[model samples]
Target chain A: MVIKRKVAVVGAGMTLFRRRMLETGKELCFEAASMALESAGISMRDVDAVVLGSAPDAFDGVHMKGEYLLDGAGGVGKPYTRVFVGGGTGVFAPIAGWWHVASGLFDTCLVVCEEKMSSLHPHPQYAFWGIFDHTLERPLGVNLLWIFALEMRRYMHVYGISEEEIAHVAVKNKRNALDHPCAQLAAKITVEDVMRSEPIVWPIKRLDSSPPSDGAAAVVLASEDTARRICKEPVWIDGVGWSIDSAYWTDRELAYPAYLAEAARMAYRMAGIEEPRREIDVAEVYDPFSYKELHHLEGLGLADKGKAAEMTVAGVTARDGDMPVNPSGGLLGVGNPIAAAGMMKVCEVFWQLSGNAGKRQVKKDVRTGLAQAWGDLMQFSSVIIMRS
Target chain B: MKEGVVKKGQDIGVGRGIEPNPVGSKYAGIEVKESDLRDGRYMSIRYSAMFRYRWDTGIAVGRFLEGLRDGRIVGSRCNVCKRILVPPRVFCELDFAQIDDWVYVYDTGRVNTYSISYIDKQARRMSSPVIVAVVELDGASQGMGIMHLLGEVRPEDVYVGMRVKAVWRSREERKGAITDIVYFKPL
Candidate 1:
């Protein structure tokens, strides 16, 4: 028990995840922020502060991006701030907002995250090349997929897992996305189709990955008293934790994410959840690739090491499974807009816990749920727990 | 604080969500639609540039580069952890101590993991695929793989734990870069 005020996510809003949209990054933030304020039954005037999140200056093709997106994020004339942790910024933005309200500094906080990956030429993936070690790894002509592919192969080799077994996650998530209104690449794909799909890198295929997207997401947070007054049901962020490993990614075993496990341990301790496999009702994890969902699940302690892929094989992570994950289609199906996609995970938890996710609702009666996002050379993990 | 002139949209109404207005209605009376932008009613344009950087490859990386230029693979060994770090650095990230010594590692190593890349770094499809592997050098440590291209082997034949050795360019061709080593060939 910390002596901080409790914080609740009163409302959330998001634009459809798509390959490209007419809206610029700021415009996207405005639409999502406005919708979120409306959902909370309030206008921007009622908010005391604002927090924003987006990944990379290269993707948006601008510098000083925090202030660039300020007015559209409803941050003008308020205590505005920005938080960035690459892909982890999605969940991390709300976590920042959580502390803003919890610290008694602001009664209401607006959190917005946006990414316009289409603005980058060649492709969004090209912007990722800049993140590697400029002196060492970059000179080798490396790309983002190479690292993910390397990690996936190591994980498979260590645990004796197969690509075919991992393809099941693609099948499950795409089918799950068919029910999501904002999904970009939702389809009835099969493991066979995944096996036959074109490979970008041998282990990572076209269907196995999330599409590059341009989108934005927003949420409104308020103190306990304010939430009770403004919302009929406010989803409580019971716990939050984040951890980042060394930048020397190659030094550690690529098969597992010790960073995420450490973060999950801290969050579970704060929430008083000892048996995560049984206690957590549902989850929405970062899944830019299908193998990533399994990797993150094990990291979250919801499944044992080497068991996440087996659970996917058993259909245990389905919408109706004992502990469902990614009920809103996840990044693989919805779209990978980086920071916005991470924020979308927070939105999914809010929607699921409040019974507001219309067609993509998990069969489980979810009173407690978790959302997580990983970023930066497989080194960072952020977690947020919510209860209805 | 002013940007562009805004025109009224025909779809404005109570509870109709004015967010669809592309030019913004922040001033209460200002709004514009997608059609107005098409008709050149508002002024907005795209801008781009090619930015470059000249980063100083300090201490650790500098030594690593020097070693590569001399046709040798070097690693830093920490006395406290007793682990050798390839692509050598000056200090151990886990322990806050400076490394005790620079150790020479065998160029031969086993592939930890690899990928057959059909696309270039820019996400453009390549005419021919490149084979990239994370090779854990024999003396550096397990899981500490230096990422490099693989050559003289079929893509299907490249597997985890497969033995490989560096295929270097001629000494005259050395450029003090990771490309100094052309590719790793199967031993």
Candidate 2:
């Protein structure tokens, strides 16, 4: 494994995830970026470069959304780049920032990820209609729910899992969110309540879904030299890896996330982590749907296949339990603002590793943690490993 | 299609039942100084995109639409997978192979699942709850359901595995859109 220069997360910031924000996308980016800079005790003038990530321009009804969010993110005249991989964009944004510092091209970099799904008309999910092949798939008038439902069905079939078993994830994540300050749907509920709730698609209920939200998150990354000199308890970026599979989502097995496994393996290998379940203290896996968290848990090697859901029910993933996952309440509990959702996970990992997660802190001494985001028809996966 | 205009005149001595357009519409505009505008402040660069769709699933979808236009329902079968896909696809998902053959299916199915959406996408309040459901078409693969509107069942009555069938609009009101099937009702 090639060892790159060390980089550290000096600070992080995020706007409240919500259904609507009167602030435009650029304004939200500015708010988050400014807060991140303040937290880092630095100014935009000190930043050497900037990296921005946003999921889709379609959701904002603005093409080249990165460019639109540039100035607000302090990318006006600096060496800046916009990187995107759907919902994976947010986590990937920090990875890109890490590379900027790790490559020794810059000593400090500002990373920003933002999404405004509320701006899309009809429904933001309607934007997903075009995510399909315009020639082949769009003709069917397929909605986004179909793909998720089909994946959920296949996951259930292959894992010998029942809908009731999956409902426990909704119960756990929502209950966990009760302590999250930025959570949108934080509540205490039961598996019985999830099963009794109205289903949007078979095996996928309204409660199982992440709400459309408008939010932004920003993180400031710096070289080891700059980090040590300027800040205390800088969370080091131990390893970063991202991968994208073929866009032909239907051809792949929906029951398993091969891309995520590949991405996690690459990051873990670089981080020299031989056994993830034992070494990693906490995790912030993406969970846009309740089943996805369990699915990703398996893919990240935290648990064996067909075992994540069971482990979840056994309370192994609770904030106070071993191998705590999504202690930040996750996308299922906190609202999912797409790009921002991934960065929110990264921010949570930073807070947890820095001993800043006040109420939702995990029980273990979190010396190392991992955050992963998957998106783009389940084809893109990004992983980041951070250590104190 | 037919197009025309209708005109109605007032009865005796009411001067054509017409009134002048209402006035007093208020409009306000403000201008700010360049200095007050926050010079060098952040301003987003704008961009736009337009996409044209030439979908070929039209052949199978056309048949499905025609079925709705005629008060029937249809789907397509994947010969390789042997699974009938409603709102059918042109290719088989499992094999990633072409699916050229189309199969007609009965409208009768079951409400495999459903949700009562209190608010629309815009967060607007609806006068009545909208029942969005997944209806597993007859002869389709197990657990396979096409999303559609549901009616004639209270929110509490709608449950998984409840049998239902499509309710089409009047023939004269038929359109190629999914809305052509007004809603689904208990079988």
- TM-score for chain B of all predictions: 0.76, 0.67
Q: List the residue pairs that clash in candidate 1.
A: A90-A343
After superposition, candidate 2 runs with Cα above 4 Å error: B1-187
Spell out the clash pairs found in candidate 2: none
Residue B153 of model 1 has an lDDT of 95
| CA lDDT, every model vs. true structure | 0.87, 0.80
Candidate 2 lDDT over A62-113, as tens digits, reads 8898788998889998998999888888799899998899988999999999
Residue A18 of candidate 1: its Cα lDDT? 79
Per-residue error for B182 in candidate 2, Å, reads 18
> List-wise, what DockQ does each model earn?
0.38, 0.05
lDDT of 2 by residue, B75-180 (tens): 6778887877776768776678888777777888876545565544333445676666657778867655666777888877776668998887788998766677
Q: What is the C-alpha RMSD of each candidate to the true structure, in Å?
A: 4.5, 13.1
Error of 2 at B167 (Å): 20
Interface Cα root-mean-square deviation for all models: 5.6, 10.4
